[model samples]
Target: MRIESPPPSGIPGIGLRPIERSDRQAWFDYLRLPEVHEHTSWNVHQPEDLDPLFEIHESVSPTSPRRLAIVDLESGRLAGTIGFHTVSDLNRAAEIAYDLAPPYWGRRLATQLCRRVTDWSFETYGFVRVQATVLVGNERSARVLQNSGFAHEGLLRAFRMVRGRPGDFNVYSRLATDPAL
Candidate 1:
């Protein structure tokens, strides 16, 4: 399923929309940066690697793995992306993920992005649980989740591979019943 409109970010000069083909260059410029991918598990090594991500799938279900660009309204630049990594309608659950370019970091943009997407997932998809996994030691990301009302659930031992080696991750989650931040 393709998401046409992203929920309002509540941040001035920032907007969200489905990631498009036009964004591939800008997305790759930052996503492949060592500073940006160091804390996440993105495997992007070249621009072509992101092609699959931009394909618009036609489906009625809103649970498909898709990303929305966090854009700069004035310059029309790709500031970052936030979206669902996985969704399980049967379980009323989904995993959320996000990343911001180096230039856009440290502006509280991540917190707003996460909050808006989490709320949208609950309301739009009828999901009861929205979760996120931060590679261990990615304190900045963990803080974003915490500020967005995701409580740390626990640590998963060797949960994923980061930059080739197995890495642990800290799981966090926000439920529909949780008070909004």
Candidate 2:
């Protein structure tokens, strides 16, 4: 599965498009936000810290992570990013993750983003499962996954290192046979 070019995410009010070079600054800025970084595993202390992401997005392939920029339909500004990582062809599964700018929080855009990408991943790649790991305390993200039709699988105790210390994460998954709400 050599991902040459992905199509637009026909999600209403927002479009999920491939990440571009111009999006680097906006992504960097978003990652710098304390509210945004608090939930993610990456600790981006400087602008240069985002350079690797830019590099990966620049040379994306099917074997590489599929990163898409979630853009607002009205403003055309990047609301956030959502993507599938740790894709396993043998397992027909992948790990999904997303983050939005603080301004876009509580807009329900994250749910839509997750649905579009999850549907796309299953439809496009024949993936049987898509999983998301949300930090235990982040109820908002948990709700986003639930609203998107993902079921809470279980908890991975001290699964990820957030900021610096280890933290528990609630595992969530949506199977291809699951209902799309």
Candidate 3:
């Protein structure tokens, strides 16, 4: 594949740039929504607790391609964030986690954001697979993956220990070979 450059509009809906560090509070506000956070990689939110984790995004090595913040074009708000932290070069794969602010839910923002980043990853970095795990009850998160072309691969009983309890999980994956991709 030639991996053409991303659109001049810079990947459309998630196009708003530079992911202002000042938006950290807004990002924290998103986490406070139970609808948004129940399925999140981080399950709880408090004003003081978010800064350190938000810092992790900010601290990504400048040369490292593992992190990003995506903004909403219409509102210039931090729609959400997406990143790859557990990466395997040999397998050409990475695990991604992202979410749109609670108010942005159901607007197809998450799907657009996922596609924008995945396209960038595949075209820019040659990833063969992108994967995510959603808690079984989180219909919203599951829909985001499905709408973005990921398929449910498997289910694991008590697959993840989240918020201190064993919970069922659905593993969703989208391969570079996927027709929709």
Candidate 4:
């Protein structure tokens, strides 16, 4: 019952693919940026903090069958990454998450990528729902979900122990029956 990784989104100008070792530097560089993690899940990430992720990317295509490295095909660079995590096939649901290189922000790429991925999941896995949560102050992420057609759900007080401290979260989601982009 392995889920195949979703095909490239066919965004006309960009493609997202499973990450590769060659992408290590690009991803590392982006995560290393001080502003990338601001008001998000992590307080800060050292290059060493991502060692396991790089290892997994190099050695495995995880059961999740995800790890999309955003590519600006025109420039052929791995601008960032997005993936579905904590997926539960039996429940026909999954949590969607993503991040882009800071330089790639504000271009609507995040919204586009999220939409493409959600469409693929609903179509391929018959997923009844795709959900996302954001740190309350992460307006950008919330906007991505909204722009991609998700409905705002509610807030979770002290929702997660992010970077070792309790932090509030705002939930949002889109169902298979929701509007299409």
Best by TM-score: 1
Candidate 2 lDDT over 1-181, as tens digits, reads 2244555666667777777768777888988877876767878877677777767655535556678888888998988888888888789899999989888898788887788779888999889999999988888999999999999999999898887799999999999999766
For residues 52-95, could you state the per-residue lDDT of candidate 3 as single tens digits?
55565555443233545567677777877766656777788887
* lDDT of model 3, residue 27: 76
Could you give candidate 4's per-residue lDDT for residues 1-181 as a string of tens digits? 2223646766777787777667776777777676776656754355566656655544333335356778889999988888777667688888888888887898898998898889988887788988998998888999999999999999999998878889899999999998677
| lDDT, candidates in the order shown | 0.87, 0.82, 0.70, 0.78
Ranking by TM-score: 1, 2, 4, 3
Segments of candidate 3 deviating more than 4 angstroms = 1-20, 58-65
Better of 2 and 4 by TM-score: 2
In model 4, the runs with Cα more than 4 Å from the true position are 1-5, 54-65
Task: Please say which candidate is ahead in lDDT: 2 or 3.
Answer: 2
Which runs of model 1 end up more than 4 angstroms from their true locations? 56-62
Q: Ten consecutive residues with minimal summed lDDT in candidate 3? A: 1-10
Provide the global lDDT of candidate 4 against the true structure.
0.78
